[model samples]
Target: MQQSPVDGLDLVFYNVPHAEAPAELTFAIPSMKAYCGSEIVAHTLHNLYTLRGAKVRDTLKWVGYLDQALDHTQDTEIFFAQHHWPVWGNKNIQKFITVQRDSYKFIHDQTVRMINAGMNGAEIAEAIKFPETLDQELSIHGYYGTLKHNARAVYQYYMGWFDANPANLDSLPPTQVAKEYVELAGGENAMIKLAQKAYTQANYRWAAELLKHVLNYNPNNKQAKDLQIKTFSQLGYMAEASTWRNFYLTGAMELETGAPRKGVSTEMLLEMLEHTPIERFLESMAASLNADRAKDVDMVINLVFSDLNESYQISVKNSVMHFKAVPKAENVHTTLTLTKPFFLKMVTGQSGALDLMFSKETKIDGSRLDLRRFFSLIDKAPGTFPIVTRK
Candidate 1:
């Protein structure tokens, strides 16, 4: 079972042979397709840019689905969705689908036109305004994905990440830039004074921006930190979009509670590894490598997942890690053979690598010292890193 796209309720699909259907009855709909009786209502303004996170959705593709839904469901009497009450009559269903469908189409088409006219993401996000009729429609309201974010996502999808500006191409990382800003603004006390004034003026955005620099410079600044919590709380309360509200309120809660207390558990890590493609998992490890620690290290290790019947070689060179899914190479620093579960446990800190080697859960050949050195260079990342405050 999976939730319908817009209404956010469970839908269950059942299989039926073609011979069982009446000549007039069909399951296929052009864009908004479904199986059996599980019809999806394009009732709500579906997430054009989902905040909880996923690939940026193609609003045009979604509109195409709606077009198909209109052609297929014309004769249907009742229109039901996951979250909201069903529309009982044919006319009402048509009205609901037509308005919702057109709203998405308008947004998609207008954003594309703006992009072709040489508008950037932020410009497009601010420029596109909904038609008065659609804007006033209760069904297609911005209760989830708002116009501001959806427009930006559309622009990014078409134009890519570069804003066609050279300044953004090689910008300093956030912490470095924040430190510079703090120094330029005459240190913590000066920033705190400015932020406190902004807070008083109800300019929460500026206050949060300034205080962030202060907090990044000194994570222990109680006054700056407390003001940020207040700013996030106010922003959370004022937000109409559910996702925006959740993000702000959650940030406040994290500040109050000292970040999320949970780390990736062994079971969770194992489940993730079990489902992930081996090549993708290896590629991800490059991102997780502690480059500073591994700067001078150059080694290669053969990994054999015996139970899964997979073999790969991992190479570390010039502070970068690379992997290929080929037969294990003979010349290597170490060769470790283990089941996928055992590997997950060892990596997630649930089981000691040396203990696993001794227990025969992991069979290691070649230099044990090389394996130890390699593991030492791997940084132990905290599960819950601070966001609003310094780590």
Candidate 2:
């Protein structure tokens, strides 16, 4: 769609309909390559699988967007993206889009091909590699999304989480495995000694790995924690990608000083709540429920948002929370009415139940005890929860 607000300028929009991918809406000027952030880029490979976690992107739909941009902007002279500088000249623009498109397609196709050929995720990741001609290009280098992770992402996208290995199907959890490893390796002191040796040899990767095992087994091990801090710092300094470098450095900082006790900002809380669906929010609440604490507790709470004109009925049964958009007011233990602003304040720690009740911001229509019990079942993660160090 092209919209001209002025006499001689038109902004054209290009995005895949009903699909989640980068540069949800990109603008294009006539005879200029569209500025597609992740859809099409000039330099540095876009994250096919985002580092911070998101929905799996549709590679086919992403490629389709690139094709649409190409067909519609045939007279383009140069292109630019949010992540990097511009690529000038028609030949270079064509080549950039072509390479970017093919890179994603190759990863998706080859991963599926290997899957059909009986190769699992690890094997496919090890086997897949871009041709030398493409890999040598500075534009699509593994600065963000490494080939290994993207390959694994593709496999997981197509074939779900289970790898069909019976042994892996019922393996012990991380803490259990860590305890076993510590015992088998002669305890925390012995593990720390080995990690120190690895650190001395500049094998920071192995050092970090070993330290994680120790921390999991005995979180109070000061030696293990200090060594992990050093190893992560070294790893951060050596990383090329900004995201990778930042994460590593942050991990080290948290290990040394603990996670910050900063609360969510008003702007951030609003943004998150605005984009998140009601169903997803309820699902997250369900996930965060303290099952052991709520084993014998059951309650129904009807939440009515006055500002948004929306209502949801939440029911807890078997220590799991279930919610629906339409109100099921019947048999409800309590019905709480509050505006979006008040709800935001309460959730972000700016206000509490007492403030809401005292200020009449949130009106409680039924048993306050039921609401109190429901709230107590939701575990409150400490503001400065551990990250690099064990919890």
Candidate 3:
């Protein structure tokens, strides 16, 4: 609407439907978010990736609104998305919006088609590339998101979180698997040497690929360190996702110099915690636990937040931690009474909820040493990670 006068065409910000439009093309992101301002449509597209697609597992129904985003696909000569830009001409805009809205729709629809046809998300994503004409566009690139991930999300939208494989239901996690991979690959040094050879052979991609697995298990190995540096350089030199480029570059930097995680904002964490599923919070805590060191230690801490009127009983028995919310009926160990913001900090180790022990902010009836030991039990997953392969 703020264009510098296009042939004296009325610069009307048309909120009218495509059925009413007599314009070139209509562009939108389907929705909007931070970073990309209004007028440009953007979807975070993370949940788009996680749920359904991987070969290992599938996801269940996505409870979010899909139609609310897609229904605005009418009345446009061209539609410009916020992340990229707009495509022009009535035919083009209609096709573009239809393609995109239908892209999510197709993945959702055709996936059920394929799922009924006996294919999974991984199988479907591999088979579901858009036509060459659409795929050629750089804006449709898999910089931040990929077809594979999106397809899986659609699968999750219907089937729920499961890969239909029992082994994966209770299988070893990524880090544990990575550790075993390192052992089988004749240790980190051997893999690093292999990665170096690949890098030297101008196979920067393969080198980066092999090196990440080595680093995942032994993040501090000198050879793994050096190879990853080269890999980041290669990725940074070629990446289109500024965020992806930054993730690779920053991860490389952190490997050389162990950068401690600066805590996520307390307000944001509290907002997330207050409404997030208790299971998800426990999963977050499980991700927080240092599985390598989590052994025979067993303990539990009960916390009560007066403001929210909630109580949680967390038991760390046999190194596995369990957290559940309930009424504070019987006192167990520690009763940390604090605001949600302080509790978020306590979980992340940025600040303490147990500071009541010293600050006189609240009351506590648990062992001080037990509280400290409990804090030591969990591991923190990183906010971002490097992509080993480009797809």
lDDT score for residue 166 of model 1: 92
lDDT of 2 by residue, 1-391 (tens): 6554435666666555533454467667763444444334547666656778886667777777767766655667767776667777777778877887788788888889899999999899889999888887777877877777778888877887778988888898767888998888899999889999999999998889888889887777888888998999899999877678888989888777766877445555677776666566567678889999989987889989877789999988897888889853767899888887777676666787677666677788888888878877887555566666554
Residue 113 miss distance in model 1 (angstroms) = 3.5
| Clash number by candidate, in order | 2, 0, 29
Top model number, TM-score: 2
What C-alpha lDDT do the candidate models reach, one value each? 0.74, 0.76, 0.58
Candidate order (lDDT): 2, 1, 3
Error of 3 at 152 (Å): 7.2
Please state the error at residue 19 of candidate 1 in Å: 32
TM-score of predicted structure 2: 0.85
Model 1: per-residue Cα lDDT over 140-186, one tens digit each: 87777678788877777787789878999999877788899989999
> Which wins on TM-score, candidate 2 or candidate 3?
2
Candidate 1: stretches off by over 4 Å = 1-43, 52-54, 78-90, 116-119, 175-201, 261-273
Global lDDT of model 3: 0.58
TM-score, per-candidate, Cα-based: 0.78, 0.85, 0.54
State in Å the error of residue 218, model 2: 2.1
**CA-RMSD of model 2:** 3.2
